[model samples]
Target: MRHLSPGELIDAAEGHAAARATAHTEACEACRRQVASLREALAALRDVPDDEPSPLAWDLLAARIGRAVREAGAPKPWWAAWGWRFAPLLMVAVLAATAGVGVTLWHQRAASGSAASAGAVPGADEALAQDADGDERAAEDPSWSLVSDLSAGISLDDAADVGGLPPLGGSERALWQLSSDERRTLASILEAELAESAAAAPIIPGV
Candidate 1:
C-alpha cells in the first residue's frame, strides 16, 4: 500500500509500467497527480525547440584551449632544470680534482727520481769488483767462505774497524811464530772484527 516511487510514476506517465503500478496509480490519488504532472512537463519539453550552439562559441572555446596549451608548453624535467643550474660548477670541480691529483702524482714521481739520484753510490763498480774478488778468494780458501757469506749484501767500505788491519797475503806461516799473548790479542781482535762484520751485514731476500 506504499505510495509509488518517482521511477514508477515516470513509467506510469510514459505508459510503460507493469499492470501492478497502473493499478497502484489508479488507487493512489497522490501517485496519480504526480504522474499527471510528469506527463505535462514532458509534453511541455517536447513543445519547446532546443537552441543550437553558435559556431563562434565553439571556435572561441577551441582557441582558448589552444592558447592555454601553448602557454603551458612541455615542462622541463626536474633533474634537467637542476642539472643545468649546477653543471658548470660540477664540471669545474671535476677538472680541479683531476688536475690536483695529476700534480700530486707528478710531484711524487719527481721526488722519487731525485731521491734515487741522491742515494746512488759513485763507487758501485769498485764495490762490485771487490765482491767478485771475495768470491774468488772464498772458492780458493774454505776459511774465507764464512767471510763471503757475512759480507754478501754488505759493502766493504762499511767495515771501518777491520780497515786498519794488515793484509794476510803472505803472513800465514808467521802466524804460528807469534807469542802466546800476541796470538791471544790477535784472536780477540779477529773475533771482534767478525762480530762487527756479522752485525753490520745486510739481510738479503730469498737467501
Candidate 2:
C-alpha cells in the first residue's frame, strides 16, 4: 500500500486517526517515521509558553493613570464644549472627503476597464515580462537568454522545423542498423515479459 501523507501522519501523531488508519500506521515503518517527525514538531510548539501580563505591569499602568487624573486642572461641563457645536460640520466635511475619494476611484476603474476592453492597454503578463526584461538589462547581469544564443536568433521557420521533428527519429536511425543477434535478443526479452505478465494473471474457468 502507499504511505500515509503528512496530514494523515499529523492526525496519527495527535491520536486522532480512524481505527483502520491507526492499525495501518502501527504496522507501517514509513508511517511511524512520519508520525515521529510530526510529534517532534508538536513538542516544539508545546514548549513555547503563552505569555501573559504580570501583576506588577498592571499596577504600574494603574499608577500612571491615577497620577494623570490628579494633575489635570479644573473639570469643565461636557455640553459647553466647542467640539460638540461643530460636530455636524466635522461629519459633513468627512463625508464630503469620503464621497470625493469614492467617485474618483470609480471613474478611474471605469476608464481602466474601457481601456482593457478596447485592447488599448498592454496585458498584465506582457507588462510584467517587459518590466523584468528592463530590470535585467539595467542590472547589466548576463541573463540565461544573453549567455546562450541557443534561442535568441532562432527564426519562426527554424522553430517550426525543430518542433515538427519525427518523434521516433533516434529509434528509426538505430533500428535499421541492428545485427541479427541483437534482434533475436530483443525478441527474447519481449517474449519473457509477455510470459511473466500472462502467468501472473492466468484465466480461471468454472463449470
Best by lDDT: 1
Per-model TM-score, in order, reads 0.30, 0.28
Candidate 2 Cα outliers beyond 4 Å, as residue runs = 56-207
Report the Cα lDDT for residue 39, model 1: 95
Give the Cα-based TM-score of candidate 1 against the true structure: 0.30
lDDT by residue for model 1 (56-88), tens: 989999999999989988867655544454455
Q: Candidate 2 clash total?
A: 0
lDDT, candidates in the order shown: 0.57, 0.54
lDDT of 2 by residue, 1-207 (tens): 877876777788997987767888889988888888889998999999989788798899999988898897555554334334434533443444454334434544455477689988633333223223332332352332232243334355643443432222234224323454554454456546855997887487441
Backbone clash pairs for candidate 2 read: none
